[model samples]
Target chain A: MAQLLPSVWRHIPERYSLLGSHCENCGKDYFPQRPICPTCRRKGKIVQKLMPREGKIFSHTLVHAAPAGFELEAPYHLAIVELKNGVHLLSQIVDSDSEAIQINSPVKMVFRKISEDGKQGAIAYGYKFKVVRNAAAASKPGKPVGKQSTSSKK
Target chain B: MNRSGIVGYGTSVPRMRIKVGEIAKVWGKDGERVSSGLGIIEKSVPALDEDSATLAVEAARVAVEAGKINPQKIGAVFVGSESKPYAVKPTATVVAQAVGASVHMTAADLEFACKAGTAAIQACMGMVASGMIEYGLAIGSDTAQGKPGDALEYSAGGGAAAYVIGKPAESIAVIEDTYSFTTDTPDFWRRQHEEFPEHGGRFTAEPAYFKHVVSATRGLLEKTGMKIGDFDFVVFHQPNGKFPGRAAKILGVPDEKIKQGLITPILGNTYSASSMVGLASVLDVAKAGERILMTSYGSGAGSDSFWFTVTDKIEEEGRRQPESVFEMLKDKVNVDYATYAKHRRKIKSL
Candidate 1:
């Protein structure tokens, strides 16, 4: 089963892991495993492991003009996710409208497709964050509109 | 006169190989068609993880290994490629970090289509000549992607070459004279952040390759007070083997002198890196006091010609490096077309 798809298997662990690299020499953490330790200039001591999947959006931008490979996926939000480990990751914000995304908004990582060159294999299932919607707006005194689940009994 | 030359050199190519028959099968074309029409039998492709930056790092490592130059002493690193990984970011910074160049050195990217590699070398020469820095590294590398089944795909491949330029006396090859011919014409162009390049094929064949190369070569010869007969060798930007040969015949450079050490037959059209890689191969065979006339052209319409005479100092430095260019070519492993697609990540339906 695994022999048929080798690259797919390599990416399975990346699906859920908020991956980051820890510098063995300086004890510094980087969102992506750096080839060298920036603090120490030491080589070969940086090790890779999982990072926190939940964080707040530090900053974001809506890209209107993407590269040739990402043209069709335009108008998507790209955000800098600040994880608990002090490592910042640049990722796409998905499953939520761009209007709701604000600085410092709490978000959780979810798997989503970035884009495919169509000729190259699609970059499958990478990390993205979503802002949890507020519940108070759905329920009001005059209208119990949040009761969609309750009405399901009919 | 400061000696600025290649102290070391390195190269990296994808392990996977793609053959002509495989491409012919997929595209419903004949294997002979790709090999004969495009002048490429096989091309080295980069894996999904490999980009221009990574390939430059691979080449820079080889350059460093061939010399006694200190990493911290390197005052600048320049990467020239049309296929940079990011639009806003500087690829030189990533490549510098990858090869462990000094953090304080100036790092930047240069673009001039295929002529960019030689352009970077000219820039390095300027900096070294001015005494702004002690040593600088100029790299020309690319992971050029041609559209599937397009005529370009057959000749586009992934590779890189790095040269360390410094004082000429201490260098391998000293820059003698440089001549440039520039015009505003779009023979071929790729817009910002574009994956595929657009071209006016027949126009480029005439005006871009033949017209510019002859003019630039003649310009350098006249300026340097030397003629075609004085040079032991000539190197030109090679989009394909046939084009350079045709240009050579037009310039009266002779088939034997022009064909020696030409790399497109194996490495494919590396865009900006093509001519410089060929130059590096020529340097391997060039002797002290032997004159070399090199002409470089970019697709947007620009060419630079330089005259150089090898020094005895470089001949000694050559021995400290890897086995000759021929050995490296023998060490390579060839692959088929499907693997090429996978390496370049060109097949993605699921």
Candidate 2:
């Protein structure tokens, strides 16, 4: 708990809202935020920037061998998503089919639980990307009301 | 930022679900019987990473984004949940920070069973109406739990809803009036360290949910001089598909009034977010100038009744989002019982 809490606290902006840094000079974006731009050095004008919530899949892989903490979530899809500004971040793909995941597929960010320290430890939350099934009208409104599956009355 | 109305609204339902039959099979019971008895098909299952806090954050983020309201003006944040991730810490703070709300705001977590969400709404109304803040974010969410074979396992589900309350002129719906009725009827409760709650079975009906809900609703009608037919829509705490209808019957609200808001059959009982999500559902398709009546019940027990008048801003550009209640309901992924247990942490490996 002690080791995990401090790190999560320090990276709240990045983890919660995807706050990163963008260099105006070299026109590059960074995750985990960089104080000094490597390309332009001191001459670069770097400012805090919020990465876009929508991106495209640059590359992906199927991880059947789960890590120590993520044993329950074996055989998951891990991908590197390319943001709008060309910044790429490695993350897990969730709520999508293995066949549906392809390079350059449009995806959107969603908040989700990342990991927990252990039994009775702090729960960490961050963004995960999902393949976009439908960008417009995920479901239509003003449909006549109907029973989903079960009857209300006995 | 006019007095006390809903400026922004959003809802979140986890994509994963476990059918009642899957759960019933594990317990060696008739799946069809249990499904019919509870009036539920399946319930939303939180992914391994989702909990009360994550759900709240997602819903609140959508509320802020959909309404196009600047988070800097939000003055208070109140999260209502019985399934908070941290017992000693406040989930409201996590939500406030996630949405980039200003630091100079009051925040806390509240609990009172399913109606806790409405309680938070009432608190925000008072604060905004009294000039304590410019705007307040109220959230209701839960990752409800149940014992392996308990009846609650059939109906308990996970979801969240968030509302941004501010002046009526800037709101999508103006909250006309509100009322509450409370009594020490202990029909259902969970002790300090208990994981799942216990209920009084049939006693949960007439004397608890009906008594408080009916009383508060009737009291509101009497106080506001409004009758059942004056409301175009009615929403009640949906612990199950049958309970809301039974309560509405006692209140003289027609079945059509409950039709638009009764989503429990598909999503199950979202606990604190139950009635609040119904309000969001009604707001999704309600015409401007339409009237809505809502009542929420928490089983310790008490009920809160509210009246709303949808404003023209509801249909205005940029105020509404694509993530409607109906859409969240449609976006679902089916999972088996073993996967459900693993995702919900019921099969802990630590």
DockQ, all candidates in order: 0.01, 0.36
Candidate 2: tens digits of C-alpha lDDT, residues B80-145? 999999999899999998999989999999999999999999999999999999889999999998
The residue-by-residue lDDT of candidate 1 on A1-154, one tens digit each, is 2342466435544443445677787778876556777778845488887777667888989999977655544667889978867678888775455677889887766434443334334323345666644434211111111111111110
lDDT of 1 by residue, B1-350 (tens): 44355555545444334655566777888888768776666766665545677667656756765656776778888999988766667778756654556678898899988888778878888888889988788888888878888777777877787887777766667778788888877898887666688889788888777788888899988887787877777888888768888778888877667665477777778887887777767766666677777888898888888877777765563333354443444434566666566656676741
Q: Candidate 2: TM-score? A: 0.96
lDDT of 1 at A4: 29
Give per-model CA RMSD.
20.3, 3.6
Candidate 1, DockQ score (0 to 1)? 0.01
The count of residue-pair clashes in candidate 2 stands at 3
Model 2: per-residue Cα lDDT at residue B113: 93
lDDT of model 1, residue A136: 41
- Stretches > 4 Å off in candidate 1: A1-154, B1-8, B317-320
Top lDDT prediction, candidate number: 2
Task: State how far residue B216 of model 1 sits from its true place (Å).
Answer: 1.3
**I-RMSD for candidate 2:** 8.0
